[model samples]
Target chain A: MADITQLEAFVTQVRRDIVRQVHKVNSGHPGGSLGCAEFLVALYQHVLQRKEGFNMDGNQEDIFFLSNGHISPVFYSVLARSGYFPVEELNTFRLLNSRLQGHPTTHEGLPGIRIASGSLGQGISVAIGAAAAKKLNNDNHIVYALCGDGELQEGQNWEAIMYGSGNKVDNLIVAVDLNGQQIDGSTDTVLPLGDVKGKFEAFGWDVVTIEQGNDIQAILEGMESAKTKTGQGKPICVLLQTVMGNGVDFMMHTHAWHGKAPNDEQLASALAQNPETLGDY
Target chain B: MKTYIDTGKKDTRSGFGAGLTELGKTNENVVALCADLTGSLKMDAFKANHPERFFQVGIAEANMMGMAAGLTIGGKIPFTGTFANFSTGRVYDQIRQSIAYSGKNVKICASHAGVTLGEDGATHQILEDLGLMKMLPGMTVINTCDYNQTKAATIAIADYDGPVYLRFGRPKVANFTPENGSFTIGKAVELQEGTDVTIIATGHLVWEALEACKTLQEKGISAGVINIHTIKPLDAAAILKSVAITGCVVTAEEHNYLGGLGESVSRILAENHPVPQEFVATQDTFGESGTPDQLMEKYGLNAAAIVKAATKVVARK
Candidate 1:
């Protein structure tokens, strides 16, 4: 088990990396990236039983697929901090010829990323596939995927959701970042994802919810419980109720910061809130 | 002139089934996923033999494509089977992002391709699949001519790394290729040798090109036939060699003249050896409900069409 204080410090550092990377590029998705910092931190640092180092074929290790790849800022941060790559590489996020693309991809030979996902609603299906592969190999490792709530509107997600549970893809856990905000506006105004929990349940998934998704302890607990629900003949769905731009005060609770980079002054303010816990990249 | 024999008539999908069944027995890592077309795609044997390795994705081609891409992360070679239309157009973005862009080893096995899919009409018969797949960077686009070649290609793609689009058809065509032939990717097979004109074709059109070659030989045209199974990473060398000797070429395929095998050959020739060329392909039109032969004849994708194009191109030369 990871120490609570150490995990909290890691979450704070990830938040700093998210803001810094997006601010450095002056382009990227910071809202969702900032929102899921703690969850991703918990996942990599503690939750997932991953193998040492990185290989393209994650044969016996726990694999994660980021369906909402716009959140590459936080994902790259967590992956780097987890020793998948050098922490300094986070500085190259979305830069020309950088391994850290605008969206997470295995194309550039990025260590942690398994699939390319930016065009939404593809990750859950891919996770189901990896889980199925694990079952075939008798590896018995769980596959995890994170998706956006707004991304659920893509019809492919429903198809994948139905297939996952219908086919008893029980060795997978899909987490939906239910921040309730998209690029345009709140999900309610854009396209209401009515009762996301009910929707997953209707699709035959075992649904769980983390009321405080940004809280490191809560995320760790929820993920631990979600892990226990695995291998029960139904895929798991975790509705992570996070605030958009979670750690930063002004950026939180709004869709304005969804894909926009924070200005110079705003970056300083965002950095102030996060603090230099593990040193800036 | 070289001669060939027709072993029998069989649908290329059956060949896919046979290959997949063979893979199930031989390779434990080879997994199959079908979008509710197990019987149509002829994946039933594999499904029955290795129930655990087969995934019935139930009418969701996009999700199936995503899953196939994901499966590759764990070193599992995934073969996604579906109709040509649903396989390419319906899930093109899924394949582009998840499989091709990510450089995953996924075999996208598409059956019931071209107008010869027959009664299904234009909605199901995808004439642009070859073009759609070939345009993607690093995607290996293959259109097998007969049952034997289709089966051999299916098994061959498992060993070959990276993304592949293997197109076959539903109707019983002339199964002339060797039963256990060595299927090489990006290498054109020369069926006949001549100097008057080169007849290059793919998929069902390969048989038509061969038949046209026989007709041309009767007329003292002495045409050469080359079966170009792989369209992308095209055998430019083989095409150049054939066109260098023949001085003119006629490209045939069950696809549109634009962006199909015809255009690919034209580009190769224009860059290296500019030759008088004629296309024996659909002229940018969708097909309607009809028998396989009727559709082939109406679309000018038959041997007679190839002969007409060959004669015209030879005259131009």
Candidate 2:
């Protein structure tokens, strides 16, 4: 295993990248990006059993899908920092003619992306399909997908959720970013997602809850347990209860910053809180 | 006029089934998915033959479309099957984002298209699927005329990499094309030579156009027939060549004239060789419950309709 301190440093760097990239464009979803920095960092830097280099057909290796692609800042930061592409390309996030689309897509031939998401709730179905393909190809690698809790309201998610467990899609893990917040207001005030874990369990999934979702150690440990639950004739669900904006003090525990980027002074303040762990893009 | 023989009659969906069954035996990477319409889509053969490769996503077309796109990532070709309505309109966003925009190599095989679906009425019939599919960038839209052509097109698409929409119907119609004939996407088939009028048709109307050609000959008019199997990336060269000789054209289809094959041909003629054209399609309307023949007749999508349209447009020239 690598050093935890170094991984934490990478997470801080990813946070800096997220806010800085959004601040430059003056438009993006920074709250969810900051909130999921550790999860994505832990996923790319440590967890995923990735093959060397990138190809659209990710054969013989673990593949990932980002369902909540509005938080693309963190996904792009982690992917670039992990050597999927040049780190300097993060500067082009959300810019026209750039591969880093506002949401993730494979149309521009972006490496490490198998499907286009951002319409929400579709990543689960796509991941389930990939998992079945791996089974067909006799590849023992697992498939992982992440979606926002608020995205669960899309109806198509339930269609896919029912499909995954009913067909015994056991070689997959779907995580929910349970920030309890959406664009308008908190999930409870907007539309309550009652008994999220219970709903998954009733739908024939193996549920794994991570209460300390922002901590690198907690995410790693929770994901490790989720991995162990795979290949057991049931699809796995990871409920990650993270603060909306975890790292920056002012951005936390509110729904206001979900899609709003930081202003000039707010960017400086957000960057100061995270500190410069590695070099900035 | 050159007479063509109907070897037999068969539903186009069976042709899809035959092609899929052959692909299941030939290509290991080919996989099939149906949203609770395995029997209706004539996919039972492939499902039974390749149970491991076939996915039965019950009653969820949107999920099936997304899954089909995902299946392509691991070098698998997924063919999603359902009615034309469910395939195109019900799950358009799923198809647009996951398959079309993402550029996945998935074949969307839609059966029971247009008024030929009959008795099921307007809710199940989708006369605008061709328009919807062709609008997407890089999507290959194909509407097969008969059983043999549909079978060939179905097998041919497995070899062509990219997104494709293959449309066919449920009723048993005239199987006129050669058995085991060569199928080429975007290539038009000119059925006869004429000097008076050209009858360009797609889907179930090609056979009707041939019938109209015989009738027009009896009326002392020479009408040529051209089969447009592939609508998008339309065979503009063939249409122009035929229109140049005939000087007037009648476009026929089991779809609305607004954005169907008629409009595509209109754009071509309006730009290249300007000619008088008449549309033998639904005039921006919906269909209702009836026999396949009754609906085709009521919607003016049959041989009589083609004859009148051909006679009228030929007069303009």
Candidate 3:
């Protein structure tokens, strides 16, 4: 596993890339992307056992699925940094005919993405399916799914949660990016996701909460604990409490930055918080 | 009109059950998933035999669809069974992202499609499923008629890669197609050959089309009849050839005319060979509770309706 300093540097670089890439396009969901940066870095660096040059049928390595696909900026940055595709492709986000679609998809033969997931609430089910497949094939590889807390409002997510827990999808781990903010407003003001931990627990899943979703050490610790919970005859859910748009000072604590890219001045100020660890795309 | 010997009508879902059970014996990779509709979808046989492989999702169709998609990742061919309504509309996004967009090798088996679903009414009877499924990219939409063809389609989808939607029905219809006949995806099978008019039909209405052909033949109006089992990636060559000879077309299906087999056939004919066409189908309306025969009559999906449609099309020609 990488050291905390290295992981922090990697995460900072990823955040810069996400903000810069979104700023370049002037279109994308940055709030969740920024909020979940530390968790994303920890996942690629320490949690999942993945290899370079993407393989769709991953047998020996852990598989990951981004259920709430709006956070493609974070996902794209992590995948590129992890060597799934060229980092230069990050500049082509949402461009016409570009493999880096507005949402992550396998249609363009994007290296790391095995499924199109802009449509929320479907990823958990796909992850369950992949995990189930791993078991059937005796691969022993676990499937990890990351979904936004707001995305759980989608009926499909509930269906997936119920099915996974009821059927004993022991090889799956579902993580909720609980930023508590959505496009319209805060989750409480929009539609209160009353007791997400309790909700998942009631659904028969073994639920855990990461107190500091924006802290790399905390995120890593939470994920390691999640790994230990796998293959225990129950699907596990981690409720990650995070602030929307964590890195940028002005963007934090507001839903306005949920999908808005920072202007030139805002971008400059945001980039100032974190130095360029790796070169920007 | 010629009447085939009575071997007793059988529900197409039964064919699906038989085919899935047989497929399990042949392919160890074959697995089944149901959203609390095992009996309704006739997946009981597969569930009984392949207990480990069969998954009862318990009223969660979306999850059932997703798990099916995931099952395909490990080289396992997952067949998800449910009513047409829940299969297409209720879980459209799930299928769109996980299966269709991802290009997963999952088979979505939907039974009790169209008005023939009877007492369940419009909620269960999905007339728009054909249109909904055919519009998706890389989705092979198949609406099989009769017991043999449904069985054959179920067995065949396992060999074909990528996502496929197999639409069957609850009502029993003819079991006439040869048990040993090859099941091709986009090949249009000509049931009866005639030059005056071509009667194209799919699903439960193919039997009505054959009957309509017989009636037309007896009345000295040689009407051709073709069974278009596959709706998407339509057999354009066969359709154009039959249309060129007949010079007129009549399409029939147990679905709404808007995006049904009729519309697909008409679109093909209009583009390739301009011809006058009439459709025997529901006229963009929801179905009500009634017996299967009554619903077929009300929806203009009977043999007499096909005969009338053929006459009108020939008159226009």
Among the numbered candidates, top DockQ falls to 2
lDDT of 1 by residue, A1-281 (tens): 67989999998999899989998889999999989988898899888889899887787888888999999999999999999999999989989999999998888998987889899989988888888888887888889999999999999999999998888999999999999999899999999999999989988999989999989889988998999999899999999999999989999999999999999999999988878888877
The candidates, ranked best first by TM-score, are 2, 1, 3
RMSD of 3: 1.5
The CA lDDT at A168 in model 2 is 97
Write model 3 residue lDDT over B122-235, tens digit each, in one string. 888889999999989999999998888899999998999989999999988878888846899988898777899998999998888888888888788998788999999899
Question: Mind giving the per-residue lDDT tens digits that candidate 2 earns over B103-193?
Answer: 9999999999999999999999898999999999999999999999999999999999999999999999999999999999999999988
- Clash tally for model 3: 2
lDDT of each: 0.91, 0.93, 0.89
Deviation from native of the Cα of residue B153 in model 3, angstroms: 0.8
Candidate 1, superposed: residue stretches over 4 Å from native: none
DockQ class, candidate 1: high
Which is the better candidate, 1 or 2, if ranked by lDDT? 2
Computed on C-alpha atoms, the DockQ of candidate 2 is 0.85
| Ten residues in sequence with the least summed lDDT for candidate 1 chain B | B1-10
- Candidate 1, residue B218: the lDDT equals 91
lDDT of 3 at B10: 88
Lowest summed lDDT over 10 consecutive residues: which window, candidate 2 chain B?
Answer: B1-10
